[model samples]
Target: MSPSKQGKSQLIDSLYQKAKKLHWKQCEQCRVKKNLFKFVR
Candidate 1:
C-alpha cells in the first residue's frame, strides 16, 4: 500500500514477466507468485 512497497512489488512483477519471457522453466505463474511474495517478505 505504501509507495515504496508498491515500487518493490512492481519491480518484482517486471522481473517475473522478464523471467517468463526468457522461459524460466522452473517458474509457473501460480507458484512463482507465492515464492516471490515470500521472498519479498
Candidate 2:
C-alpha cells in the first residue's frame, strides 16, 4: 500500500484498539451503540 494509505490504516487500527478498551469502561447503552457503529463501519 501507499504510505498515506498505510498510515491511515494504522491510525484506524490504533483507534479501534482504543475503542475496544473504552468498550469495557462504557455504560451498557453506549457499549451497544459502539457495537452497532463497529458493525456499520
lDDT top scorer: 2
* Backbone clash count for every predicted candidate, in the order shown: 0, 0
TM-score of model 2 vs. true structure: 0.59
RMSD of each: 14.2, 10.9
| Runs in model 2 lying further than 4 Å from the true structure | 27-41
TM-score of each: 0.55, 0.59
Q: Put down candidate 1 lDDT per residue, 1-41, tens digits, no spaces.
A: 99999999999999999888767655567688999999999
Model 2 scores worst on lDDT over the 10 consecutive residues at 22-31
Q: Which tens-of-lDDT digit does each residue in 1-41 have in candidate 2?
A: 89999999999999999998887667777878999999999
Clashing pairs in 2: none
Deviation of model 2 at 38, angstroms: 30
